[model samples]
Every structure is written in structure tokens, then in C-alpha cells.
Target: MLFTQAVRQFLEHLQAVDRSKETVKGYKAELGYFNHYLSVKHNGPVYLEDIQLEDMEAYMQHLKERKKSTATRNRVVYVLRSFYGYAVKRELCKKNHAELLEPVAIIQKERDFITEEELEILISHIHQPVIRTVIQTMFYTGGRITEMKNLKIKDVDLENEVIHIIEGKGKKNRDIPIGKTLHPILTNYFENIRDHENIETDYFFAIPKSGSISANYVNRLLKEAVDELGWNKHITAHVLRHSFGTNLLDKGASLVSIQKLLGHANLTVTSRYLHQDKDKLAEAVNLL
Candidate 1:
């Protein structure tokens, strides 16, 4: 069988299975790029079983030369592995060369967060009620952008001062307690603007009275605040969540506590939020 024919069958399998629409689209695009590379590297009539191991290795190097990130490379490699595995099962290929490919190491980027000083400046300068409240909620609750957008008016417990993330990442529901400093901001946004506007939608940060606030819009708002403060950092809603975790760490909160509050699946993911502080390191050495 031709290599393209095998790839087409694999894609059809993805669409016929449990893969989401977005996942299917992304895999299609990735495989399409791979097919293009194969076409350029060799003349026509490329057979599924004819691809040598050297060709597989060369394609891996080609990805690196294009400066693809570790995650992108890993995803591409995974797709190919699945494809070639299918080909092997169907007797179209002798073996799956993509299976033996080693994954690239993913280096976590430097944690970008808002300093306390920058936080104060950002809050003071944000005059719009909804926009300001959105930032405040993110900073205080450490809710994912999607979680925040999905928040309903009923999710905020004004009496208890808590926000409920009904279905965050992993489809896990969690609660984040409100800090005293952020209480008034959320209270007023809930009781005043959201109520006063009589927003036709029930979402906490719903815009246009039709749908929830989008992640892109939230980031754009954050960018405007960063630009106004002349801060060089490219801060976003996710950065605010990082700031929440880092700030909690500074306040002597445990990694386990942060993991639960941030709805992170494990301690390792939560640990990345704990940035190294010179003063904290000094204090630690002194204790030793």
C-alpha cells in the first residue's frame, strides 16, 4: 500500500473514534505536513513498507531543524506512531519505525507572574467593573480561564466568600476560598454591575448578554493593563494564576494545598509555580 493511503485510513479511524473535533483537525494537519515532507524528500510512489529507518530518523532531524517545540515534536511523533502501528497491524508495513523514536525533553519556560507592586498598579488602573473583576477573580481564585468563563452567577457564594470551579481541567470540580482583599471586588461586581446590567446570561463574566468572556478577550485585557503600566512582561490570565500559586508559596502554603486549590492533578505540576527566591533561599540556609 502507498504511504498516503495508509495515512488516510488512520485519519478516518480517528474521525470514526472518540477523538474530539479539534483533536482530529490537529492530527490531520500534522500528518499532512509529514506527507508533504516525505514527498519532497523522495520521488513519487512512496510505499508504506518501503520507508527505511534512515528516512524516519531524517524526518525527526528535520523537525528539530525547523525549531519545533518539544511538545509539538512529541505530538507529531505520537501521531506518526499511531499511524504506523495501524499500518503494521494491517500488514501494510513490516514495522513501525516511528515507535522507536525517542521523545524530546520539554524544558519548562521561566514562570512569568505579576509582582505585588505590578499587581497593585494593575488593579488600581483597571476602572472597568467587569474587566477589573475578571482579573481580581483570577488572581484570587487561581481558576483556569475556561473555568472562570464557565462560572455562573450561582457559583459565587457571597455569604461564604467562595468560588466553585464546577468542571475545570480533568473534569474535576473544586472550590477556591476568597481572600479578604478580593472579597469586595467580586461582591460589588456580582451585586452591582452584573445585576444592574441585567445581563441576559447567567455567567459571572458573560459579555454581550449572550455568551461567556473568551480567553482571547481576557488576555487582550491583561495586555492592555500591562502596556499601560509599562511592564515588559507579557502577563495573561494564566500568569495571574501563577502569581496566585507563587504568592501562596511565599506565604508558607504547602505544595499539596496549592495543588488542591489550583486543581492540579499532582504535586509536580504545582511545584513549577514555586519560583526560587533569593531571600527564601537565604532563610532556608539559615535554618540549616
Candidate 2:
């Protein structure tokens, strides 16, 4: 079967299995990019069976030539692995060269997350109720902006103090605890803003007539707050999430609790946020 056609089948399977919309869209775009590169490299469409290790190596080199970041190149290669795995399952390909491709190490920099005090400052500065609540939710819940965008009114449990994250990253469902600060912020938003808007849609957050609140808009809102506070950092919704884990770690919360709170599949991923604090480094040096 044609390689591009196989990609379509794989993406459809992702949708059928109820993968997150961003995952489906991102994987589709990445695969499409690879398909274009492979077609150009081979001077035409290459069949699934025609794929070889050399082709995979050349594609990696092509990504480097294009000045793609290590993380971006890794994602493209990972998508290729998923694609070929699907092809192999359907008997369209004999082997998965994408998996056999050498690993590319990503040098992930530590993201600057807001301090608890800064979060309070940010919330205090955001006069807009919807936007304030959105920041509060990210700080309190550690949810991705996409997860917040996908949230429905029904997902919030006010009485129980839980936010049900239905199908977060890795297709995992988790319930994050509602913080004392966020509970009041959310209550006010619902009572004053969200209810007054009378939006017919089930989505918890949206602009009037614009449908759901977009990730781009949320980023802009954060950028404004960061600028107003004179914070010399690029903080996004995910950075707020990083803050959530780091804050908890600072407060003597166990890594196991944080792993569960962030819905990380393993402890290693959760451990990344623990060592960035200067206090933690100082304490470690004194142990000698």
C-alpha cells in the first residue's frame, strides 16, 4: 500500500480510539511532513515495503539541515515509528525502520515557572474574571491549556473539590484536587461571569460568540501578565503546570503524590521538576 494512504489509516485509527484532538492533528501534520520529505528524497512516492534504514538516517539528517530542534526531530521520528507500527500490523510493511533509527538526545532546558507569590500577584493583576480563573485553574490543577480548553461544565466537581481530566496526555483520566485559592476563584467566575454569559455550549470556558477559549488566547493573556509584572521570562500555561509540581515539591509534598497529581506515567518524568529550586541545590551541597 502507498505510504501516505497508510498514514491516513493510522490517523483514523487514532481518532476511532478517541485519542486527544491535538494528538491526532499533531501526528497527522508530522507524518505529512515526513511523507513530503520522503517523496522528495526518493523522487516520488515510496511504498511502505521500500522503506529502509538508510532512508530513516537521511530523514534525520534532513531534519538537522532544516535546523529542527532536537525535540521536534524526535517527535517526527516517533510519529514515523507509530506510523510504521500500524503498517506492520496491517501487513503493509515487513519491518519498522523508524524504531531501528538511532536515538536523538534532546537537551531540555528547565522552564521558568512562576512562584506561589508570583501566581498570587498574577491573579491579583488579572481583573478579567474568565482570564483570571483560567490562570488560577492552571496553577491549581496543573492541567495543560488544551485540557482546560476541552473541559466541560460537568467536569468540575465543586462540592468534592476535584477536576476530572477526561483523557489527558497518554489518554489517561485523572482527577486533580481543587486548591483552596482556586475554589473561590472558580466559584466567583461561575456565579458572576460564566453564568451571566449564558453560553449554550457545554464547554466551561469560552469567549462570547467565539466558541471555546483558544490556547493562543490563553498564551497572550499569560504574556500580558508576565510583561506587566516585569517578569523576564516566557511563561505559558504549561509553565504554570510546571509551577504546580515545583510548588508542591517545595512544600514537602512527596514525589509520588506529584506523579499522581500530574498524571505522569512514571516517577522519572515527575522528578525533572524537583531539582530546579536553588534551595534544593543548597540543601544537597550541605549534605557532604
Candidate 3:
């Protein structure tokens, strides 16, 4: 089949499999690039059987020349692999050219996290109750922004002082301890802001004035707070998660516990947050 036809079939399969909108968009972009390359290099639409390893290599070079990040290149390559694998499964292609393709190595860079003092400063400056509660939730639970946004009132166990994360990364569920430090604030925020009549809706952070708060609004509020404080670090909701893990590690929390709390499928993913506290590392090394 023609390359464009194959791409259309692949996107249909992705939709059937319930892929996220963002994933669908990435697949579309990557496949579009592949189709464009085939058209430009071969002067017409190349059939699936005409794909070669050299074409894959040239595409990698094209991505590099365009200054795409290693992660972006890796994702595009992955999308290509998935598309070709599907094509082969359906007998549309004789072989998958992307099967042996290797993604570009992504360098591990240390992530930036806010210190306890900096977090305190940011919280002090945030006067809005809803926003403050959202920030506090991230600080205490180490939950992802999506998790926080999707939180349901039923997930919170006030009597037990824990928040149950029903849907997290990799579809794993876990309960996170809610500290007493944030309990009263959360309780008050819920009482003041939550609509008791609409208790059936699962969203925990919904505004009564609107349907639900978008993740973009959360990021905008965070950016506004960051800009007002004139902090040099690039702050995001994930940074709060990083800060939580760093603070716990600084206080001698174990890697295994951190992994479970963060709902990470792998211990290695949780380890990235462990070494973010340079001052604590220096102090420990000096003491040793």
C-alpha cells in the first residue's frame, strides 16, 4: 500500500486502541514527516515495501539537522517503529524497516527542584485558596499534576489521613500519606470551595464558577507565581513532585518508599529525584 494509506490505517488502529490525543498527535506528526521524506527523496509516494534502512538513517539525520532534542527524536523513531510493526501485522508490508532502528541516546540531566524555604516563599505569595490548595497537594503527596487534577473527593480518607491515587502512571494505584501540616488547609478549602450538590462528579479541584479547571490554568498560575517571585529556576507542577522527593530523601527516606509514594513503575525513574539536593550530598560527604 502507499505510505499515506499505511499512515491512515495506523492512525485508525491507534484510535481503536484508545490512545491519548497527545499520542495521536505525535504519531500524526512523525508519520507525516516520514511521508514527506519519501515524497521528496523518491519524487512520489513510496510503497511500504520500498522502505529501506537507509531511509530511516536519513530521517534520523534530518531530525538531528532540525535541532530536535534527543527525547523528541527518540519519540518520533518510536512512533515510526509502532506504525511499521502494525503494517507488518496486517500484511501490508513484507518487513518492518524500523525494527532494528535504535533511538538516539538521551543524556541524563539533573532536574531543578525548589528548596523548602523557596516553597514556603512561593506558598506565602499565593493568596488564592484554590491555587494554594493545589500547590500544597503537590508538595505533600508528590502526586503528578494529572493525578492531582483528576483527584476525587472519595479518594481522600480524612479519618485515615491518606489520599488514594486511583489512576496514576502505568495505571498503578497507591495511597499517599497526607501530612497534618496540610490537613486543615485542605479541609477548609474543600468546605469552602467544593459544591456539595455535585458530589457525584469525581473531580476534586473543580471550580463552582466553571465546569472544571484545566491543567493549562494550573500551569499559568504556577508561572505567574514564579514570575512574581523572580525565581531563576524553571518551575512546573512536576518540580513540586521533585521537591517532595528531594526533601524526603534529605530526611533519610528510602528509595523503595519514594518509588511507591510517587507511583513510579520503576525504581530507576524515582532515583532521578534523589540526587537533586546538592547541599545535602555535600554535607554528608564532608561528614564522612
Candidate 4:
């Protein structure tokens, strides 16, 4: 019934459920911070049953006073709710105190995307053959950086012109079509860089030196490319995905098709990438 016991159980449950390393670490860090706050405030350990609405309110206030962003505060509250839910379900607590707590309001900010012209310029400047191919694939497929990085040779069905996404976010698998424009580049990469290598693994992007490139390495390369191009816009691998979705929507692709291509479970999640122009929205309304 002690806080430490509950924390340990929560972590054990998370591991049992096969949670991602990042997710588990985040939950542990957030809950550990909450436990530390209770200990410091009360001069002793606080049990799950000892938690009150005031304690929750104080935690929210503490986060706010520390100038945590709305998004971060919301995430912390979410973690608390999940932990308390676990406790309640296991009969460790009579009720879920954290469940009733409200998250801070988060304003949905529009994401910045590169224009088609800017993308052309950026791609033109990237000299590395493999890096250029990877960047192009991201733009064309709207695949996450990890999805692309973790891609295997078998995942690409060149004859079918489709790329298989295995174990994407939320453990979902889907296939997206590869554009004809990228086929030649992909074929060349495979024939030149991949064919000669004695790779025992199936990963498509494995380098001769490192085997596989880390997400940090991809981001660093993207940063260097962005700097070399002297573009003021914030660019990352995710931006390439956003650009693909936006481009599709601009070309009048339906939300349903885009959702499937992006492997978004919910249409609402894919709606974020629709990014309709104000002028287009107005024009459609006028026709209506």
C-alpha cells in the first residue's frame, strides 16, 4: 500500500504489457517526480489512499509555477491517470483519484511545412546519395523516421511499387505505395550500395560502418542539410512526412486514403495533416 510498492508494481505491469522503452522511462520519470514532490511536501511517504484532490491541485500548481508548457503538464496528468487506473483495477486503491483530475488546456498549433519549391531546393543541395534517397523516400511515403530507418529490404516490393511498414507506432502494420519518381533512385541504391555489401541483416538503410543509423544521426544530418540550404523554416524528418500529407491533400486526395497511407488509426489524427489553405476553405464554402 506504500507509494514505493505501487510504483514498483506499475513499472512491472508496464514491462509485462510490452510498453516501448521510451514510454516506460517517461512514466517512471514522471511518477518518480510526483512521489518526490509528495515526500518533500509532507516530510514522509504518501500512500495511494493518502492522495487527495488538494494534492493533485498542488502538483498542477507546481508544474505551472515551474513554467512547464501546456503539452508537458497534460502529459504528466495523463501519466498520473494511467498509474492510478492501474492501482484501482488491481484493488490496490479504492478509487482512482488521478482519474478525476483535469489536464491543462493545450492549443493545437499548426505545424510548419516546407513548400514544394523549398523542398526542391533542399533536395537539390543534398549531395549524399543514400541520404538524398532516404529524404526523398520520407517525402514520398510520409513514413516516420523510425519506420524508414527500420525498413528491411524485403519490405520494399519494387515490382508492386509498395513499401511494407512493419511494427509502426501503436504496433500497427500497413503498406504505402512508393512513387514512380523514386523507383530509379531506390533501384540504384540497392544495386550499388546494398548489393556489394555482405549484409546478413534485412534492414535496407544499414551502412557498411554502423550497420544502422540512429534517429539522432538522421536528425543531425537533416540539421546540417537545413543549415547548408540556409532555410529559415524548422525542418526535421517528421516535417518530410507532414509535407507528403499536405501535398496529397493539396492534390485532392481524400482523408480516408491519406489516413491509411499514414497508418493513422483515427481519421482525426490524419486530419492534422490536411492543413487546408484559408483561400481554399473560403472557395469551398462559397460553392456550398
Candidate 5:
């Protein structure tokens, strides 16, 4: 089978298994670059069996030459591995060339987070009710943007004060408690802002006549608010999420509780938000 054809099959399988649209779109884009590279190198449609490990290695070099970040290059390579694994399973290819492609080491950086004061200021500047509610939800729930986008109106339980995160990352479902601050905001959005009756979609943040809003749409809304405040901080949805975890820690929420709330697979990932105030850390130590 042609490389492109195999990719099509793999993407179709992803959709058949109920993968999110964004996930399918991401795989298509990353695999498109590899297909383009193979087409240029071989000067025609490349077959799945004809792909060699060296060709994939060369593509890694190509990405490096273009100054792709370590994380991006690693993600592309990971996608290629997923693609070839599917191809091998389908018997379209005899060998999975991508299996040998090594991932680049990533240097972890300190995550950026918005302080409660900064977040308050940022929220004050967002004029759109939908955008404001979305931003608040991220901070309140510690949900990934994809999880937030996938949220349906039925997922929220106003009476019970919990938001059911269905099929989050790694196909995990968890519930986030609706806090006092966030509870009222969500109530206002549902009652006054969200036109669910006319929108014709179950998604909580659905665009009128459309489906769930794009991640880029949420990013652009955050960027506009940041720019208006003349803040130099690079705030994104993930930043708001980090802010949520960090703020919860500041307020004495335990790591285990946070792990469950954020739907983290492990406590180690949730522990990255351990940057407590210096004075507080010292006080804890002095208590001994």
C-alpha cells in the first residue's frame, strides 16, 4: 500500500475507535510532513514496504535543520511510530521502520502559572462572557483544553456541584468539584450566556451553528486579554491549568487530591506544582 493510503487507513481507524477530532487532525498533519518528505526524496508515491529506517532518520535531520524544538521533533517521531505500528498490524508493511527512530531528550523548564491576583486582573479584561467562563473553567477544573472542549452540557451537574470529565487523556473519566467561586460563574454562563436551546449542540462551549470551539479559539481569547493588560507573561490554557494546581497547593490542597482532580495518571506528574512559597516552606520546617 502507498504510504499515504496507509496513513488514511490509520486515521480512519482512529475515528472508528472514537478518538477526538483534534487527535485525528494532529496525526494527519504530522504524518503529512513525513509523506511529503518521502515523496520529495523518492520522487513519487512511496510504498509502505519501501520505507527504510534511514529515510526516517534523514527526516529527523530535516526537522532539526528547520530548528524544530525538541518536543515537536519528538512528537512527530512518536506519531510516525504510531503510524508504522498500525501499518505493520494491517500487514501493509513487513517492518516498522519508525520503531528504531530514537526520541530526542527534552529539557524541562519551569512551568509558567498565573497568580490569583494576575488571573483576577486578566479575567476583568475579558469582555466576552463565553471566553471569560472558559478561562475560569480551566483554572477552576485544571482540565486540559481538549478535555474542556469535549465537555458536553450534560457533563456538568449544577445540582451536585461536579463536572464529569468523560474520556479525558488516556481514556480516563474523573469528576471535578464545582467550587464556590466557579459554581456561580458556571451557573451564570449556563443560565444567561450559553444559548443551548438555539445552538443545536450539546457541547457547553459550542459556537452558534457550529460544534465545540477550537483550541486556537481559546488561545486567541487568552492572548487578547494578555495583550490588553500589557503583561509580558505568556499565558495559555495550560498556564491556567498550572495556575490551578499551584494555587490549590498554596491553599493547602493535598497532592493526592490534586492528582485526582486534574485526572493525572500519577502523583509524580501532579507533584511538579510543588513550588510553594519560601516563607511557608520555612514555617513548615520550623514546626519540627
Candidate 6:
């Protein structure tokens, strides 16, 4: 089978299995770049069997020479591994060249997060009620941006004050409690905006007469608000989630609880939010 043909079949399989649109789009982009590289190098189409382990390693070197970040390079490796894994399973290829591909070492960088005060300032600058509500929902729930974007109205139980996050990262579903502060915000949004806006879609957040709001739209709103405030902080919808987890930890929330709330697959993933300041570190030692 042709390399491109195998990629198409693998991507189609992702969609057929109910993978998120973002997942499918990401896979398509990564594989498309790989296909372009193969075609350019061979001066024509390449077959699945023609690919070797060296070809995969050479692509990683190419990404390095192109100055791609370690994280980006790792993502490409993951995509290739998934794509070729599918190919081998379907008998399209004899060897899984991507299986042996190694990701570059990634330096763990501290993620940026806002304090509750900063979050308030950021939200205050966003004047649109719809956008304000969306930002609040993101922070309060600590959900991934895509999960928030794809949230369905049916999953939100306002009366019970529980937001059911169905199929979050790793295909895991979890529930987040509606806090006292966010309860009123959500209630007002539902009654004043979502309910009366004539938004005829299953999505919780939507533009009137249009469908669900795009993730980029939310990020753009965040960027504009940060610019208006003249804050040097690089904020995004995901940062609100990071802030949520960080603030919870500052308030003495346990890692296990935060993991469940954030729908993290493990405590290790959730533990990254444990940012300790100098004062906190000093106090910890003094406690002994």
C-alpha cells in the first residue's frame, strides 16, 4: 500500500471511532507534513513497504535542523508512531518503522498561571457577557479548551450543580462541581444568554444563530483582554485551567482531588501544578 493511502485510512479510522475533531485534525496535519517530506525526498510517491527506520530518524533530524521545538518534534514522533502502528495492524506494512522512533529530550518548563486577582482583572476586561461566561466556565471547571468548546448542554446539570465532562483527555469522563461563585455566573448565562439567544445547538457555548464557538475564538478573546490590560503575562484559555489547578493547590487542595477535577489520567500529570514560592518553601521547613 502507498504511504499516503495508509495515512488516509488511519485518519479515517480515527474519525470512525469517535475521536475528537481536534485529534483528527492534528493527526492529518502531522501526517501530511511527513507525506510531503517523503514525496520531496523520493521525487515521487513512496510505498508503505519502502519506508524504513532510518527514514523516520532522518525526519526527526530534519525537524531539528528546521529549528522545531522539542515538544513539536515529540508530537510529530507520536503521530508517526500512531499512524504506522495502525498500518501494521491492518497488514498494510510488514514493519512498524515508527515504533522504534525516539522522541527528543524535553526540558520541563514551569507553566504560567494567573493568581485569582489576575484572573479577575483579565475577566473584567472582557466586556462581552458570552465570552466572560465562557472564560469563567473554563477556569472554574479546569477543563481542556477543546473539552469546554465541545461541551454539550445536556451534560450540564445546573440543578445538581455538576458539569459532566464526557470523554475528556484519554477518553476519560469526569464530573466537576459548580462552586458558589461560578454557580451564579452560569445561572445568569443560562437564563439571560444561552436560553434566550435562540442558539439551536446541543453545545453549551454557542454564538446566536451560529454553531459552537471555536477554540481559537476563545483564545483570541483572551489575548485581546491581556493586551488591553498591558499585562506581560502570556494568557490563553488553557492558562485559566492551569490557574484553576494552581489556585486550588494554594488553597490546600490535594493532588488526588485536583487530578479528578482536571480529568487527568494520573497524579503525575496533575502534580505539575504544585508550584511553590520561596515563602511557601521557607514556611514548609519552619513547620518542622
TM-scores for candidates 1 onward, in order: 0.76, 0.91, 0.83, 0.86, 0.89, 0.92
lDDT of 6 by residue, 161-257 (tens): 9999888876778889999989998888888877554666888887774667777888898999999989888898888998889889889998999
Alpha-carbon runs more than 4 Å astray in model 4: 2-4, 18-22, 33-47, 127-129, 194-200
lDDT per residue as tens, model 2, 1-288: 788888888989999988878899999999888788889988999787887889888988988998989988888878888888888888878888888887689777877887878888887766666767888899888888888998998999888989999988988899998888889878877777885455778888866666578888878888887889888998888888899898888888999999999999899989975547776889979999
In TM-score terms, candidate 1 sits at 0.76
Clash total of candidate 1: 0
Compose the digit string of candidate 1's lDDT tens values, residues 21-89. 556778789888877888888866577778877887788889899898888888988888888888888
- RMSD (Cα, Å) of model 4: 2.7
lDDT of 5 by residue, 88-141 (tens): 898888898898999999987767688878888998988867878899999888
Give each model's whole-structure lDDT.
Answer: 0.81, 0.84, 0.82, 0.84, 0.88, 0.86
Worst 10 residues of 3 by lDDT: 206-215
Number of the predicted model whose TM-score against the real structure is largest: 6
Which wins on TM-score, candidate 1 or candidate 5? 5
Give each model's clash number.
0, 0, 0, 0, 0, 0
Name the runs in model 2 displaced over 4 angstroms.
124-128, 195-198
lDDT of 4 by residue, 148-227 (tens): 88899899988899899988877788989878877887887888867345666678877666666567766677888889
Q: Indicate the TM-score of model 5.
A: 0.89
Q: After superposition, how far is residue 242 of candidate 6 from its true place, in Å?
A: 0.9
Q: Which ten residues in a row have the lowest lDDT in candidate 2?
A: 191-200
lDDT of 3 by residue, 156-260 (tens): 887789999974755568999888887887888778767768655667877666645666777778888889989887888888988889888878899899988
Instruction: Determine the backbone clash count of candidate 6.
Output: 0
Misplaced by over 4 Å in model 1 are 1-63, 78-96, 195-198
Which parts of model 3 have CA positions greater than 4 angstroms off? 2-47, 195-201, 208-210, 283-288
TM-score of 6: 0.92
